[model samples]
Target: MKPLLSICCTSYNHENYIKETLDGFLMQKTNFPIEILIHDDASTDRSAEIIKEYAQKDGRIITILQTENQYSKKIKPWPNFLFPMAKGKYLALCEGDDYWIDPLKLQKQVDFLETHSDFNICFNASKIYIQDTNTFKEDPFRGKFPEILTIKDLARKNYIRTNTVVMRNNFTLPEWFNQLPFGDWPMYLIMIKDNKVKYIDDVMGVYRIHSEGVWSGKDKAKMIEMTLIGLDMLIKSNILPAHINKILLKRYRKYAFKAQKEKFRGYLKNR
Candidate 1:
């Protein structure tokens, strides 16, 4: 029988955390079949090696390695290039640095989606866990909310962790989606443009935050430019509400200012 869900994992240099992420997938207790497609983005570390090791033991695990780095200096169109490769009716996601804590996550989400025909995507709230300090942080976006959110709510900061989402592969993006300022934000927006997303307010996954992460780097000027550029793209696209665009613009400005201050302080201290 065909697998009901395809768990797509996109990883870079995450050797330290990839094991837990894979373990989470392997540990799932679903009655239906599932497949895991782990694509390593040409990491200099042992990440690819680790994935190969896991694939060796698990028949359902498949590993895709890039010949050269696809997204080191810049983002590459992952879903556009990778979605064609997915085999299941539903597409789920997991970052190598994050994992699912709930074994029934996939089962629950699949059941909900199969029953609720209106939902194009189904996701749950997650606990943002910082690795180094081993501390738990709350991502405000992950807070409890209504059973479903419209396209307007999806426009806000990505409330659903990448690992927590199970989307119907209805919309495919152009090559430019990978170039967007935020990967998940654009994808979420695209998914919800016509159909609303179902929310299961349970904490089903863990999102690891660390210093070397893509969003953890110390380059505020570049981030500010990227945010502005992204805002311009949204304005031109005309798919979201005007109020949502205005709110995001204000939030980006605040983030840019904070990033600028921190970056300048770091530079002065180093100098």
Candidate 2:
């Protein structure tokens, strides 16, 4: 039987946390079948070995264990690998370092999407685990979240937590998506263009903030630069409405100022 949901997970050197993530998938209580599609980007650690052990036990777990590091080779895992193999009507995302807290996470999200045809995506609030500080904080994107989200709202800022997201798998990846340094923000912007996004408000997952995390580890300057580049790509693609573009441009300026501030701070420190 075909699975109704595909949980796409991408990991590299997450040996310490992969088990928790895999267990989260296994714990989901759903009436429909769900396939777990995991891609291990050739970790130097035992992440691949651990994934192999889990795959051996679970028939629902599908894996792509790369021989060489794909990210270093500049491969985009989603479009180039995972998405093509995903055979689900709806796609759920959870990185290997993060885990779903609520066992009913998938069931609740799937139920919402099943009833609400107008909403293209559904995401719940998540708790943030700061690895360095060893503290837990509420997801900043959580409070007062709107029931329906538009492109303009996304363009202004990305409030959706990546691990908390689940969207219909009806869209194609643009060539420009491959060129971007980051993924979630632009992907959400593209997905919500014709469809509305819904917020679930419940805390169903945890987003780990560690030094090795892709975005969490990046300095302010690099982060600002990449954000502006993503906004510029959105503007050039001409996929968004004029009003949304204007909002994006405004955000681009805001990031540009932040980047300049970071540069000045670096100069002062070096001097």
Candidate 3:
């Protein structure tokens, strides 16, 4: 039987936290079947072994143990590897380091998307665990926007937390998606095209902010530059509305200005 939901999890050197991640998936209280498709990008740690152990315990888990690191070679696990294998009506994403706090996280998001046909994506709030400080921070977008969101609203900012999102598996990812440094934001933008986004207020998971994590490790200026590049690709793709194009253009100028100012400040500090 095809699963109602398919979880695509990618792990690399998450030996310390992969067990918690797997437990979060297993503890879900749902009526329908779900498949966990986990890919270990040649982890030089015990992540793969831990994943294998969990797979043995649960029939829902299917894993790929890679001999070579795909990300290092610029291969995205979602579009290229894991997503292709997902055979579910809805798709959920979680990294190895992140864990869902509420077992009903999947159940609630799935319930929302199941009932609401007009919305393609349903996402909720998450707590950010600052590993360096050993503290928890509330999601920045918590209670920030109304229930329903449009392309323009999303264009202004990204409120959807990756781990907290469950989106319809109705569209194929574009080939251009592989060119970006990151995938989640662009994926959300492309997925929400011509569809509304529903934001759930519940806190479902914890996103670890660690120095080893990719995006968390980057400086503000670098992060803005990456965002601009992703938006530039979206603009070239000709998928966004005219108003959104203008919004994106204005966004970059602001981001670019900020990046420039940050760069100038760094230069002065170094001198």
Q: Per-prediction RMSD in angstroms?
A: 3.1, 1.1, 1.2
lDDT of 1: 0.80
Instruction: List candidate 3 stretches off by more than 4 Å.
Output: none
lDDT of each: 0.80, 0.89, 0.88
Q: Higher-lDDT candidate among 1 and 2?
A: 2
List runs of model 1 lying over 4 Å from the truth: 73-77, 217-223, 239-271
Indicate the worst ten consecutive residues by lDDT in candidate 1: 73-82
By TM-score, the best candidate is 2
Per-residue lDDT of candidate 3, residues 74-93 (tens digit): 78899998888999999999
Give the TM-score comparing model 3 with the true structure, all chains together.
0.96
Ranking by lDDT: 2, 3, 1
- In Å, residue 35's CA in model 2 sits off its true spot by 0.3
Better of 1 and 3 by lDDT: 3
- Assess candidate 1 and give its TM-score to the true structure: 0.86
Q: Each candidate: how many clashes?
A: 0, 0, 0
- Candidate 2 TM-score versus the reference: 0.97
